[model samples]
Target: MFDNFKKNSERYRDYEVIAKFIRLAIPARWRPIGYLEHLVRSRTGGRIPKGPFAGMRYIHTAFGSAYVPKLLGIYERELNPFIEQACALNCPLIVDVGAAEGYYAIGMALRNPDARVIAFEMEQKGRAALKEMAELNNVTSRVEIRARCKRPDLAQILATSDRALILCDAEGDEETLLDPETIPMLAHTHLLVEVHEFVSAGIAERVMKRFAATHKIRRIWQEDRHRSDLPFATLGTTLLPRFYLDWSVSEWRPERMSWLWMEPRTVNAPAA
Candidate 1:
């Protein structure tokens, strides 16, 4: 009887091991599903390319391991930390300048349903895509798309009390976008500007100085020093590759973990 009991116990243990193995071997399908749902919502009507690996293409990155559409919609670790920082703030207005295909703008709108986003894209194709995306995400009511030749005049469009968030990815127009006079209009807004290093030395410092009196500035990410020239064979332009900088701003003290700048500052007083 004892021998029989031992055999039964061994059989039970073997079954448990097999069950655990099966569970471990079966890949979690939910992660991909969640990713797909997010993409569909963010892109709105954009079709997922159809092919043998069409599903996989939705998750691949254009320049890195981080997925392209995902990064565009949600803040990712690979981007400047300030981008995520601004998203966490209690701002009401989000200005996505150079908003290609409205990825970041749509992402911000989806995340902050109550906030209004003005997404500006210079390219016609990008504007069309952004419009479609906003509709797809059901955020058309909140996100406005403007296809313009130059940045909108904030002073003319925004009021002082409106809390604002700015995300600038203009290829090399960081200087023109952060004019000193424009700083006052953004007194209550958080600014996340991408700066290209090769274009001008001390451009970030110069821009920050304009707002230093009223806003706190932080440097969130400085991409590895790389040659800026890349063949623009596709765009029909011969623009060279350029290194870039990502910076953030706050009207008040920023969260410790969210702060990414090498230098931190305190607000001396509220903006007039």
Candidate 2:
């Protein structure tokens, strides 16, 4: 019964994804109703209310983007607790790979006033917004925004720091980039890598084995947090397309992501 219900819920969400695309394909002015909701929600900025990122400001002009759910604190329940923990620990350096719009990077910076954030974003639009967000939060001085990141980039950055945290969401590229054998600097950094089983087969297992020798590894799966339950959500907007749009694509949304959190086994041990 539960399996059937879960399947139905996914089907409904997929349907909504399709409907959102169709609705957005029509020019914004023509939408008969809820156009105001679309405009207002897609506006340029917001402040995170809770968790490690509370009070952090982010620019939101990219349209039809799904991060609205994240801003509402309804996305990624699995990571929230760890985020808060990271905040309290306040590692001296944070390496945010794929730092889209500086969410994790800037948030951690705010939580740790003494920590410096090294954010890497390859996409032009996302990089622009991330820089803007860092500046708006008055954290640009501490945020080193880079256009790209590779294993060499990470090594260079880690060489200068004592202890660091790596927050990675590099899609499937992690399989190639995160090999500890190739990048020995990883042994010094804690990690929160978003595994992409959908994009690469057997990735979760391979990645785990790679780190098992040096770190205590924990796997966290995505949790379903219904958007309607968010503190800011209202009953009337429950199924509205205005709130569903993300990144100019109302059709595309990420599938369930499995995360791997790795902590070094000892202060002196190399990252496996």
Give candidates' CA RMSD values in order.
19.1, 4.6
Candidate-wise lDDT, in order = 0.50, 0.70
**Candidate 2 per-residue lDDT over residues 204-229, each given as its tens digit:** 89999999998889999765544344
> Mind sharing the TM-score for model 1?
0.54
Query: 1-272 in candidate 1: lDDT tens per residue?
Result: 23333343344445446546645766533233233334443553333332111221122222111232343222233353454565566467777888876657776786676788888888777777677777766788988888652535655545544566777766568677656474456555567776655466666677677768756666654222111211112221123111110010010111111211311233123335
Model 2 Cα shift for residue 92 (angstroms): 1.2
- Number of clashes recorded per candidate: 7, 8
**For model 2, what is the error of residue 7's alpha carbon versus the real structure, in angstroms, after optimal superposition?**
2.9
Ten-residue region with minimum lDDT total, candidate 2 = 243-252
TM-score of predicted structure 2: 0.81
